[model samples]
Structure formats: structure tokens, C-alpha cells
Target chain A: MKIHEYQSKRVFAKYGVPIPNGKIAIAPKEAYDIAKDLGGKVIVKSQVLVGGRGKAGGVKLAKTPEEAEELAAKILGMKIKGLTVRKVLIDEASNIKSEIYLGITNDREKRMPVMMVSAEGGVEIEEVARVSPEKILKVHINPLLGLQGYQIRDIAASIELPRKNWKEFGVIAKGLWDAYNGSDATLAEINPLIITEEETMLAVDGKMLIDDSALFRHHDLAEMRDLDTEAESETIAREHDLAYIQLDGEIGCMVNGAGLAMTTMDIVTLFGGTAANFLDIGGGANAKKVGAAFRIILSDSNVKAVLINIFGGITRCDEVAKGILEAIEEVKPKVPMVVRLVGTNAEEGRALLADADMITAETLAEAARKVVAVAKEA
Target chain B: MSILINKDTRLLVQGITGNEGLFHSQQMAAYGTNIVAGVTPGKGGEWVMDGKVPVFDSVKIAAEATGANTSVIFVPARFAADAIFEAADAGIELIVCITEGVPVKDMMRVRAYIDQLDTRLLGPNCPGILTPGVAKVGIIPGDIAIPGNVGAVSRSGTLTYEVLYALKQKGMGASTCVGIGGDPVNGTNFIDVLAMFEDDPATDKIVMLGEIGGTDEEKAAEFIATKMTKPVAAFIAGQTAPPGKRMGHAGAIIQSGSGKASDKIKALEKAGVRVAKHPEELPDLFG
Candidate 1:
């Protein structure tokens, strides 16, 4: 659910946060046009959801339209952290007086949205927290009462901001909070909230991560999902309502719950096999969904075997077995498959899968051992 | 002798007219939970589950009519926060929310709002409490566990069942088991249930199942080291999970270099709790 810097800035601007005028460009010509409009001094930033864009040479400063075009062309096709840069943001470059970091995120211990500010900015906040430890200031916001004026002032003063900039800083902080809460974002951050030569505050960079469970309520944010940065199998799994994450291994795993799914993956590893992916069919998954999950698992070329484990509580194992049969009929998979069904209707589920060309086990330990051995043989 | 619910507990189901609510309501009643009433907002004046439990328009009316002191919610995620508010407002002391996908923001408010009252909320996305061979509340299958001396608390549903099944095979059964949900924000954490299990006389030993996510496990380990006198066995999943990947559960992710399975396991071992590398080894960790 991570959005590009340009999209985050657009959200920040809507909440009255001051941001440098920028345009997202997909091609060199568009970058040239945007650079010219910004008076030919701009920063070309690659728009990839993953971090470390600067370290990857995906960000460059351009002095003229020609330089902007060249940098955009170079960055547009470059890969940062395995994600190809499809778009570059051309923004007006500003003269900076100082930089600060401001962010709003959920504090798991506090169980509330916490606003954090640091005097050290334009760098990863984790590094700052790890090294200095005393530079960052945090305040928990009451979800019922929200970020108050006093809390903002306290953060501003603690960060050693000049009294002159406190008012503008407060506005930007409030704006950031609104954008974060309004969009159901788990994280909303502005790195280097810079003080310009004119003494005005501007957000130089932005990052936002929306909560997936809350996406049903925010359609606008949901459409902002970037597919290029995501694994194709993951996107397909999401469409099928299956929680799937691609991993590097030989065995593909499908289980009934999140906790059990992870345990299944762990057991596979403990038995000397690696799980290719973690897939959860979730609660109340039917035959179609189960079939879709099986298909998704086999779609990975690296998967040498498949393991299906179900502890049917709300999910009936017989339906899962039927779905496996349907998928085997369609996919005609070459890989070995192991099935373990337990809980409600488990005996019936085992009966349904008795004739299939797969190994059946009575417990997870046996299933993991068998799946690993079969995968190594395959 | 169990922690949360027992024979005297009068249970009410929220969203009782819905598919999940009706199904689990019947399951709970069949498992010997005292069925009192149900609340579905618009479906009042009707009796569900073979004309035994009455349906009311709201929790207030339902609580007043049935004298129900505990509730299990099956409402949808969209209205789940409101349902919690309604349940809390109606003076239900112990509320177990079986609904999943409740937004974190709503839970934050629910947490704050409930803290002001006398309520002890269990989960917004969890399988509810179970006192085996006595009363089954939510979605945990009724047949797997038997009533005995071991107290169990976990952050998963099927994984808990797996552990319970293993314990049963070892001739060990649970006094009470609680699934605290795997959401980033939970109403009851491991420490809360650990303290409860420590106080319950029917429990002799405790078993905990945790996955990588927040620092709840580390904190719970700290609590176990400092507070509890009972012997504890534990298991943590997602050891093979890669960094920055959400492993099924919303809370089961390793972020900011924290919430690693290795770290949680180390903390638990350091606290003198036997840690199992795999779920199958969990039953043997008790010694």
C-alpha cells in the first residue's frame, strides 16, 4: 500500500501543506516540459514505492531543461530495489535554510497515532533514532481529541525550531495529520520539511503507506495502488481475496489462517525444505477461492512441490479438497502435492481426496517431511 | 475455575441474524454455552436457534431482556466499531469480538472509549474464548479440546487448535484458551491473559503461541519473567518470514528491524520459557 512520493505530495497539498510545484512525467519530453515550466532548475526523482532511491542513483539535480530530460530518461528505466522506475517527478528546486523530519504513525505500544519530529532530516529516521536517540521527539495523539495546538507547540519547541517558524510548522503538522487520518494511512511522513531562503516551509519529500484492511472505506486511495512495484502473483492473489506473499523456496504452502499459514511455512523449513510462498485462504473460503489459491501457488515456476494444510473451523475441508481436485484437473501440475486436512468434516475431506495423485498425511509433521522429500526428489 | 467464561455465563450474540452469527450461535449453544439472547438491530421480536434465544433490536434492549453479562460479536467490519460502542454502552462486562478486518483507527477509539468504562475487550478479529468441555464461545471447534489443567493463550486460531490437539494427544487439556487476535492493535494482549491464567486455580501450566509482529511477545516475556509463577511453554511462528512482508496476519510483519521471530524466541528463552522451534514440538516444551 505504499504510494509514490508524488502521490503523497498530492495528498499533502490537499490538506494545505506547502509543497514545491511538481509534475509526474513518464517520458523525457514530459520531464523537459515540466522542467521548463518550473524555470529550468528542478530535482528529478524516480517514483518507485521502495526506498533507497537516492542510493540507487535514481534521483538527480538538473540545472536546465536538457539536463532534466537526460536525468529523467536515465531514471525512468532504472531499477531501484528490483522495482523499475516507470515515472519521474520534476519539482522546483528550492534554496534550503534547514531541514526537519515530521511523521504520523501508529505506536503499537501506545495503541494510538503518534506524531514524531526530529531536527535531523533528509535521512532515514530509523538511522537517526538508532544513532542520536535524543534528537527525535514524539507525542501520542488522542484519536478522540486529535492533535491539539499545545501538542504541536511542544514538539516544535522540543525540536528547537525558531519561534518565527512555529506557526507555519504547526500548520504543516496539522495538515499532515489530516491527510494521514483522512486517507487511512498507517504511515504519513515528510522527510526534510525544509525552511526555504524566504523563511517559508515546504515539504521536499513524502511517503505514505495506507492500511490494507482499511482500504474498503477509501476508494480514492485504493485506486492509487501501484501494480508495477508489486509481485504479479501477489496482485492476482489479492484479486482472489487470498493473502499471498511470494518467497524464494521449493515448496508452495496454502493454509487456513494467518498464524497457521506461517507455522506451515516454518514446519516446511524445519523439515529441510523452503516454502516458495505464504498463502492464506482465509475464513470461509469456498471451492472457487480454494481453486484460485491452488492455481496461484502452481503459477510460480520455482515451486517444486505444493503443500495444502487445513484446520477447518469456519472453513470446511471437504470444499478445500474439492477445490484441489478442480485445480489439479485444470492445471495438470507436474509438481508433487501433499494434503493434510483436519477438524470439522476432515474425514469426509480425506475421503474426497483419497483417489487423487497426491500424498496425504495425518499431521503437519508428517506432511512437512513428505512434502520436503518429494520436492527434493522432484 | 476457568478465566473468562464458564457455566454461570449468560452469552449474547451480536449480529445474530447474519450467517456467521447464527452458525456460531448454534455451535456455542450446542457446546453448552448458556444461550440467553441475540441482537441484530432491525430483526427484533424474533427467536432464532430453534425458538430458544430471543432476538432484540439493540444490545441495550437485549441486555435488559436477557440479563446477559457477556457478548460475542459477529457484526461486519464496517459496523463493528459501532457494535462495540453499543455493547459497551449497554454495560456488558466482557465483550468478545469475533469480527475481523476492523480498521485500526476504529479500534484506537474503541480502546480509548472502553478504557473509560469497566469493560474488558478480548478481540476485534479473533476466535473467542473457550473453556473446553464446559462452554465454547466463538469459532473454536468444540470437539478438539478437553477440560484439564493447562491454560492457553495465542495470537492465532488454527495454530491454537493445532497446539490444543497436540496437548490433547499428550494427555494434556486446557482449563481455558484465549485467542488475542493478530491485528496490530488488540484489545487484550498476551500479558493481560497471562495474568488472568496465573490467577485461575484450575490452571497448572501455561502455553503461549505467538507470531512475528509487534513487541507484544517481548513485553509478554518480560511479564512472565517478572510476574508469573506458573511454568510456561511457548512457540513463535514466521522464523522463515522475510523482512517487510506481511505474513497473512495484519500484525505478522517484520518492520523497522523489530518483530523478528528470532528476537522473540531469544527473549522468551532468556526469560526461562521453553521455546519450540516448530509447532509439533510445542507439547514437549512444557518440561
Candidate 2:
């Protein structure tokens, strides 16, 4: 749900927010062409999902088109937080008079959406909070009433903006809030909203996290999801309709619920084992779902053993046991499995698995230890 | 006494016609929950689960006809936020959305709307709350929980069961166990549930289960340090998880400088909440 700076700026421009003229290029030659077209100084920034690119040398200012090409060459394919720079945004550099931070997010304490502004921009908000908490100004919006003109003015004043620029700041703040609400964004931020030496306001950088649940309302935004940035196992899990996260351990876990998955992983580690992944088969672990789960875990070559933990209430333990037996037949995993079935129909489920010569534990702790031991042996 | 639901709490199941909805509804009904009605857009006026509960097209009509004040949603992720809002508008006091994959943006709006209303939402992607030996409003196994004085709150649903099992082995029981869900922007936070646990006289010691994500755990640590007086023991998961990667839960990601397991553990330790280095040490912390 993270969009690149160039993409975010496109959305911002739609809301009438002024953004620096920029063009994205996938190749160094294309970056040089764009830089030559813009003329004068241009800033070449790596197109990655993470921040701190500037400090990491992924961002560079070029005085000439050849330099821009060189900077783009250095930035292209550069890894920032595991995400490779596939493209670069080349834009005409702005002369900054002042920089400010503006963002909107849910303030849990006040139980309302809050707009945060700080005079010190272009830095992580956490750093600002840790250093000078008082520098950050907050304005809570009443959900029923929405953001109002006065609220924007209050934020503008809190940032200590000069009277001449107050009207322009208010207008920009209102537009940003509108775009945030319209896009169904959980977080819409403009770090370093700069005032140029020419007395023009422009959004130099933008970041947005769209709410995934609201994709139904905004089909246009849903298309922006970049699957390449996600883990391979995660994308496959989603396709299979299983909740999975690949980890760097040996014991592969298949638990019935989210909480159980975490505890299963915890207990596995406690017993001197490392978990390979966190896989929640959800409440009803049917044969198909269990089969999918097996395929996911077996796909991980690091998996030394598998643990099937189910506390079935609505999900009949007997049904889960059947699914495990069926999945074992389909996957034919070489690794040993430690199965624990509790709650509704647990005895019957255990009876089904008891005939399979599979390792079974009467309790979760016991099962976790057994799985860990089996993994260590493997 | 339980905190959220009991025998007297009437329940309405949303997305009743769906596969998950029907399955969990039957389970809740079997557990003695007063499941009076169900809501499905086109399946209204139909019968499901041996025709025990009437099905309605909308939450508003269902709430009016059945007088159901609580709702459990099994709607798909795409429609979850709207379902929550519909239930909230219908005057449902509590809504437990069992649906997962709800976009964080939708929940942000839904949560904000829920905040405006008097209703409380449990999860957009969680294994709902359970008041053991009374009524089960969520998908958790009712039999695993034994009603008593120990209160449990966790981000992980199955982990909550493990904690309950650990406590049960020690002959202790739960007053109320709530899974606040693992979504980044959820309706109820750890501090909100922790405050409720602190106020409940029936609850004595509190067992908190957290994961690496956001500043929620750190906020809970701050609350525990300054607010609550009851004994608290906590366990944080994803210790072995790689940095800058999301775990199973969408909200469970380590976004750059936020929500590290080691940081949260250190924060909790500083705040007087007994940090369990391992899951096996939970029982000892309570003792």
C-alpha cells in the first residue's frame, strides 16, 4: 500500500497541489534526455518504496545533462532497504526559502483524524518527536464535521507562517486533506513542502499509504499495487487465500488462527527451534486450505519440520485432521510433522492422525518442543 | 463477569450466507450466543443454520426487527468497512469484524466513523473477542477458555489460545480474553482493552501478547508504566523475524524505524510490565 514519490505527486497534482515538474525514467539515457529538456540544475532521485534515499546517496543534484546521466546510472539498480531502484525521478530543482512537514493520520488519543505540521521539515517525524516534541503542532478534526477553514488556519499559524503566506498555506492544507480523504489514504504526507525563493509554494516530495480495505471504493488506486515489491511467499499465499509470512527458520508452522501462529512460533523458539514461517490457516482449515498450506510450507527449502496446531471450535478438529492427512498425501513432504488437535472433536481428529504414524502431542507446549526437537535432528 | 458479551447479549451475524459466516454462526449459536438474525444483501428473508436466525438484507432492518445490539461480521475484506459502518449506524453497540484483508485505508475511515458513533469495533482482521463460559462473539474456540479472574489481550488469535492453555495448566482462568486483531489501523487498541481490564474488578493479573508493528506496544508500555496498578506479564512475537519485513499480519511489519521486538521488550521492561523472554516463562511471571 506504499506508492512511489512520483506516483504520489501525480495524485497530489490532481487535487490542485503544486508539485515540481518531474518525469520518471527507467534508463540512464532517458534520465539524461529529461534533464536536458528541463535545462539548468536537476535533481535525480531513486524510485524506491523506502525513505532515507538522499542520505544513502541515491539522490544527487546534477549541473549538466551528462552529470544527470551519471547520477542516474549510480542510482539505477541501487538497493534501498532491499528494494531496487527500477526508475529515477528527474525534476527541476527548486530554490527553497523554507520547508515544512504536513501530514494527516488518525490520532488514537483524541479519537479523531489529526493534521500534523512542523516548521522543521524533510526529517523523520519520530526524530522531531524525540528531539523537540513541542515543534510538532497538531489539529484534531471532528469526523462528523470534517476539516474546516478555521482548522487549516490554526495549523498554519501554529507553524508560525508569515501572514502573507497564511492564505496560500491554508489552501494547500485543505487541498492535501481533500486528496487524502478522497484517495482513502491511511497516511498522506508531504515532507518538506517548500516555499521557493520566488515566493511560490510547491510540494517537493509526497508519500501515501492507501487503505487496502477501501479498494472497493477506489478501483483506480488499486491498480497501483506493485506485487514485485512483496515477498514471493506472501504473493503466493495471497493467491492461495492463505495468510502467510516467510521467516528465516527451519520449523514450518501451520496454525488455525493469527494469535496461535504467533504463540506457536514463540513456543517453537523457546524449545530451541527456529520457525520458518507464520502461516494462519484461518478458522476453518478445510482440506483445500490445508493442502494450500502444505504447498506453501513445502515450497520453503529451509523447512526442516512442520507443526499443525489447531484448537478447533467451529473448525472441527476431525475435519482438520482429515485435511492434514490429505495434504500429506498431496505434498509428500519428507520433513516430519508434529500435530496437535484440541477443542471440538479433538479426540476423533487425534484418532484419524494416530493411525498415520505421525508425531502427535497432547498439549501445545509439548507439540512445540517436539517440533523443535525434530527440526534440530533434521 | 465478562467484559463485552455474555448469555444476555443478542448477536447478529453479517455476511451470513458466506461459507465462513454460516460455519462460525452455527458454532456461536451452539455456544449459547443469542444469534437472533443474519444480514446478507440478496439472501434476505431466507433461512440459514437450520433456520435458527432470520436473514435480512441490511443491518438497519435486522437490528430494528431483532433488537440485536451486537454484530459479528464475516463479510469479505472489500466490504468489511461498510458493514461496520452499517452496523454502527443501526445502533449496534459492539461490532466484531472477523474479516481479514480489509485495506488499512478503509478501516481508517471506518474506525474514524466508529469513533464518532457510540459503537465499539473489535477487528477488521482479527479473531474476535470471547467471554468464556458465556457467549462467544468471534471465531475463537470457546472450550479452550475457562472463565475466571485472569484477563488476556493479544494481537495474535492463536497465541491467545496458547496463553490460555498455559494459564489453564497452572489452574488459573480468564475473566475476558480479547484479540485486538493484527491490522495496522484497528478499532480497539491494546491500551483501550488494557484500560478496560484495569477497571474490571473481576480481573486480577493481565497477560498481554504483542507483535512487532507500529508503536502500539510501546504506547501500551507507557500506559502500564503510568496508569495501571495490576500485575502485567507480556510476550512479544517476531523476535526471529528479519528486519524491514512484514510478518503474517499486514500491520505486523517493521516499517523502517518503527515497531521492533527488541525495542518493545525494552520499553515494556522499563515500564514495569514483566517481559517474558520466552513463552514458557509466562506462567512463572504470573505466579
Per DockQ, the best of the predicted structures is: 1
**Can you write out model 2's per-residue Cα lDDT over A112-157, one digit (the tens) per residue?**
5788899999899878988898999988876556789988878877
Scored by lDDT, model 2 comes in at 0.84
Tell me the tens digit of each residue's lDDT in model 1 across B185-255.
97999999999999999999999999998899999999999999999999999999999988878888999
Task: Assess the local accuracy of residue A378 in candidate 1 as a C-alpha lDDT between 0 and 100.
Answer: 92
Q: Considering only chain B, what TM-score does candidate 1 achieve?
A: 0.99
What interface RMSD does candidate 1 have? 0.9
lDDT by residue (tens digit), candidate 2, B28-63: 888888899999998889988887789999999999
User: What value does DockQ give for candidate 1?
Assistant: 0.83
Task: For each candidate in turn, give its C-alpha RMSD to the true structure in angstroms.
Answer: 1.2, 3.8
lDDT (CA) per prediction = 0.92, 0.84
TM-score of chain B of each: 0.99, 0.97
